[model samples]
Target: MIVSLAISGYRSLRNLILPLGRLTVVTGANGSGKSSLYRSIRLLADVAQGRAISSLAREGGLTSTLWAGPEIISRAMKQGEVPVQGGARRSSVSLKLGFADEDYGYAIDLGLPQSDSTSYFNYDPEIKVESLWAGEALSRHNQIAGRSGPSVKVLDSHGHRVPVLQTLASFDSMMTHAADPKDALELLVMRERMRSWRFYDHLRTDREAPARVPRIGTRTPVLSSDGADLAAALRTIQEIGDPVQLEEAIDDAFPGARIEITVTDGLFEVLMHQSGLLRPLRASELSDGTLRYLLLIAVLLTPRPPPLLVLNEPETSLHPRLLDPLARLVTQTAERTQIILVTHAQTLASQLSGCEGCLHFELRKELGETVVDGVEPPRWAWPKR
Candidate 1:
């Protein structure tokens, strides 16, 4: 479970630290940086998978995503006494993202690459610093493993400094390249846990959406991010997972509606059995909202839950009346996994906040920066470049 999350110089999320709970609901107005926060978390997960540089590149490079505000927002600037402007930069160009979990913490820093005349991928960001530490907060004594540019260091079992990698690549993460099992035991463990972080953002439910079309069957313990294997996943849950919860979730949302899977020649198709209907409706015939609700159920009640589950705007096509059921489903799912729900629906936020062991945050923009409402931000220290 992540106890805290910190982001700096990422879109409107300049210098933001947020506390997390078993079920964390983050809500805000449009352009209040909710999507930016979600993207930042995905970027942190990408780092552990050795895809951080490529992920940033796909987002149009670091320069495009970095904070465009002045390096420092002065008090006068907030009061409109002085116009916002950038002068000399007091710190290095860095976009930092990190989180502190139950027993460990991890942070990574990305910066513009040095002028590389020989490489065509000059716009790619360079990994400047990375750190893995013990406890909820990082400190000098708790620093277990870290990377400074190309040099990677780890604390051995006897607490002696051990050099793991001498010439790590600029675009590669130490989590992937230097996490030796023997020398960097903690680093390896942290990397695997980070890899288990799952994200579901706006699953496609349109007529041509993959989830609506029939696909080959497979033993799917976990639903795909695109929900292409929705039938197999639901079937897996019905067989090995908690079928009672599955049936209850469906009925809770659609009253007497239940789900059925039909497999023919290895192709799996989803069928719905609802009250007051002679014939069942196929996935392709269901409304967009209904399909999306089923996708959410398949994800939240998985037989094999990830260490972390992030849902972005799950209330997208859901009706207002269904928000309460969705909220209840999410809260129930939190018993087995940590969840972070980014949404724009006030009703859903309110419903989630009413749940036990849930944290609610309303984000607002202050001087063009995203700030959590009426809460003191967590204390954070970034690893120096």
Candidate 2:
């Protein structure tokens, strides 16, 4: 589980450290940097996948994502004695993202390209530093993999830093370059663990949504982000997973309504068998709420849960009446996997207020910088560069 995440110089987040838990809910007002925080986490995951630059390019380049406010605010500015004015930056600008866990920790730093030549791809971001450490957090006992500029080093059995590769490409990461199973076994493990981290942003359930159409049946242990194979996923759960939870979830949302999957000539369809209804309604005829509830059930009650699961605004388009059941499903999922939920809904945050082992992080803008409300420095010790 991720215990903490630290981000700096990204959008409105000047320098903020967030404490994570098994169930962490991040909530904030509009323009309070909630979405920025979510995107930052995604960027970190992209680094592990060796596509961080490509991911940022889709976001209108690095300049647009960088913090737009001044580098530093003077004491007089804080006291309202002087107007805000631009000045020379005191330090080089770099976007940093990192997280610490009980087993290991990883961090990546991104900055501008060295040569600003006139080229079509000059806006591409470059990785400046990447580090993978061991133990509960990054400390003296840690430092497994460290990369500085174009040089790479790894810790030996005798706890000595031995240079593995001296000259690496600027665009390529050591993690990707050293993924051979025979050599750099630790890198392979780290890559696999990092890849297991799943993220779901939005799922469409409109008139023409794919979940409405019957898909060819196949075993599905995981719900795809698009939810195209929802029926197969649910059927997979019923056959190989906890079917009782699936039934209870459907009955919890809609009393006397049971979910059934019908297969005909390799095509599979999902239906809701409600009481007092002569004929069950197909997925295409079910209400948006009903379909969305089923999708959540398939996701939360998965047979194979990942190490970390991130859901960004799962309450989107959901009615207030359904928030209770949705919250219950989220809490149930947290019991198996670490869940990071970012939501703008105050009701959802309030509903999860007294959840045991849950940490609530409320981000607020402090002088144009993202800060955890009422949190002071030294709350957690960060690894030294």
Q: Residue 284: error of model 1 in Å?
A: 0.9
Residue 178 error, candidate 1, Å: 1.0
Over 1-385, each residue of candidate 1 has an lDDT whose tens digit, in order, gives 8999999999998888988999999988898999999999999999889999888888988999999899999999989999988899889988999999889999999998899799998888999999999998888899999899999999987888788898998988999988878888888899999899999996999889998988998999899999999999999999999999999999999999999999999999999999999999999999989999999999999999999999999999888889989988998999999999999899999989988899998888987888886777676778877
Q: How far out, in Å, is residue 118 in model 2?
A: 7.8
lDDT of 2 by residue, 36-112 (tens): 98888888777769888888888888888888878887888767798877699877777878887777777777788
RMSD of each: 1.0, 2.1
Question: How far does residue 345 in candidate 1 sit from its true spot (Å)?
Answer: 1.0
Inter-residue clash pairs, candidate 2: none
The prediction achieving the highest lDDT against the true structure is 1
Question: Residue 247's C-alpha lDDT in candidate 2?
Answer: 92
- Cα lDDT for residue 18, candidate 2: 74
lDDT at 269 for candidate 1? 94
